[model samples]
Target: MKFVQPIRDKRKIEAMKKVLKSESVRDYALFVLGINSGLRISDLLALSVDDVTTETGNIKERITLKENKTGKTKDFPIGTSAHKALKEYLDTSSLETTSPLFLSRKGTKAIRREQAYRILNNAARTVGIKDKIGTHTLRKTFAYHAYKSGYDLSMIQKLLNHSAPSVTLRYIGITQEEMDDVYLTLNL
Candidate 1:
């Protein structure tokens, strides 16, 4: 399969927030968590309410997850934005420790992977993101933005739990144009 590249525009994020329903703060959390935490969709979707939130509605320091594909234990730190989003979502959602972090409209136990894609894609459309944003978009967005923030590829690889830097770079879809521009503006 040809690997798809995620849309990396910051404005798209703003547009997504604008289109999201006020009551569906869970959607907001999903987007924020994916982009900020760099957690895979499976791991993110697998989270229960208690995994990330305290009973008092505060975010925990770290979330421990057993990655499905790799069979490794990974810990994700909670950031301010993700914490805030979680708090807001919890206030409106009836989720419990046994409930999935995301749920279906019927209040079912789980949200299918396809539903996750739609939540992201619909929001991306509101923000004018033209690419085919899918389940993996948020993961790629997190890595790309982290790289732009001056994090090293090796560190990113480790954080992503990738076996190699090349895999991590490819996962984030770093283009040849971006690579070529690195030395174009060098000073004496």
Candidate 2:
């Protein structure tokens, strides 16, 4: 498989949101929830309306699911950005509780992995993101930003369920230049 990079620029992320929201709220919600929750595309797509919303149709404070690859139960709190986007989409959508959160236009099933890839890849290109982008970009973007925001490498590794900090660092695409800056800036 080809390696994909994170959307490193906040401006580009915002641009992607704006463009995607203009086109489809479902797509926008997908992007917002993907980056904020750091879920694999399979887990993200597998979500049902009931997974994110209460029986009364309120957004849930957190989401819990089984990871497709690791077969482990994962849970995380939903951030404000993800909540807002979900509220907007669910309010407008008429899907049932058991229906797929990101439904396909041609059927009731969740959108296929290839469709998710195209949706994100097209948005990245529209935002002038030159890096390789795919469904994995959303997960990597979350890891990258969480690291940049001063979260410890160990914490990020745990979040991504990776085996080692070095794997998390490389998976998030941290560069030699960034590592060098850490040495230069911490001069003591």
Candidate 3:
């Protein structure tokens, strides 16, 4: 498969949010959760209403899921932005506990990975993002911003289920400029 880049520009990200938010609550929440939680598109699409919402319709602090590819149980907290969007979605829709969090156009099944890609790709294009964006871009974007914010490499590696920090660094597209700065700044 061809490579896809993260949505690295902050302004582009904000523009994407504006587009999705104006279009659909489900789409907005999906993008927000993808960027904040770092889940794969498959995992994100597989989520059910009960995964993120409580019986009383409040967004849960933590979401738990077993990864389809890895079969590993993962749990992560929902950040304020994702939580707010999720709450808005839940409040606006009459979803049942077992209903898929993201429904297809027919409303009978969870949205496919291709559909998720279309949703994100269309938003990215609308915001003038020139990068090669796809469903994987969401996960990469999460890692990119997390690393940029000074999170430990090993920590991020483990969070992304990557085998090593080197892999995480390469996956997130650490630039030559940033690497050179690291070398220039550290003194003996």
Query: How much lDDT does candidate 2 score?
Result: 0.96
Ranking the candidates on TM-score from highest down gives 2, 3, 1
- Compared to the true structure, candidate 2 yields what TM-score? 0.98
In model 3, where do residues sit more than 4 Å from their true spots? 184-188
Local accuracy of candidate 2 as per-residue lDDT tens digits, 41-133: 999999999999998999999999999999999999999999999999999999999999999999989999999999998988998999999
Candidate 3: tens digits of C-alpha lDDT, residues 1-188: 56999888888988999999899889998999999999999899999999998878788889999999899999989999999989888888888899999877686799898888889989998988888999999999999999999899999999999998889999999988989998899986
Indicate the TM-score of model 3.
Answer: 0.95
Residue 154 lDDT in model 2?
98
Write one digit per residue (lDDT tens) for candidate 1, span 141-167. Answer: 888988888999999999888899988
Write the number of the candidate with greater lDDT, choosing between 2 and 3.
2
Question: Using Cα atoms with residue i matched to residue i, what is each candidate's TM-score against the true structure?
Answer: 0.92, 0.98, 0.95
Candidate-wise lDDT, in order: 0.79, 0.96, 0.90
- In model 1, state the lDDT of residue 80: 85
Predictions: Cα RMSD each:
1.8, 0.8, 1.4
lDDT value for model 3: 0.90
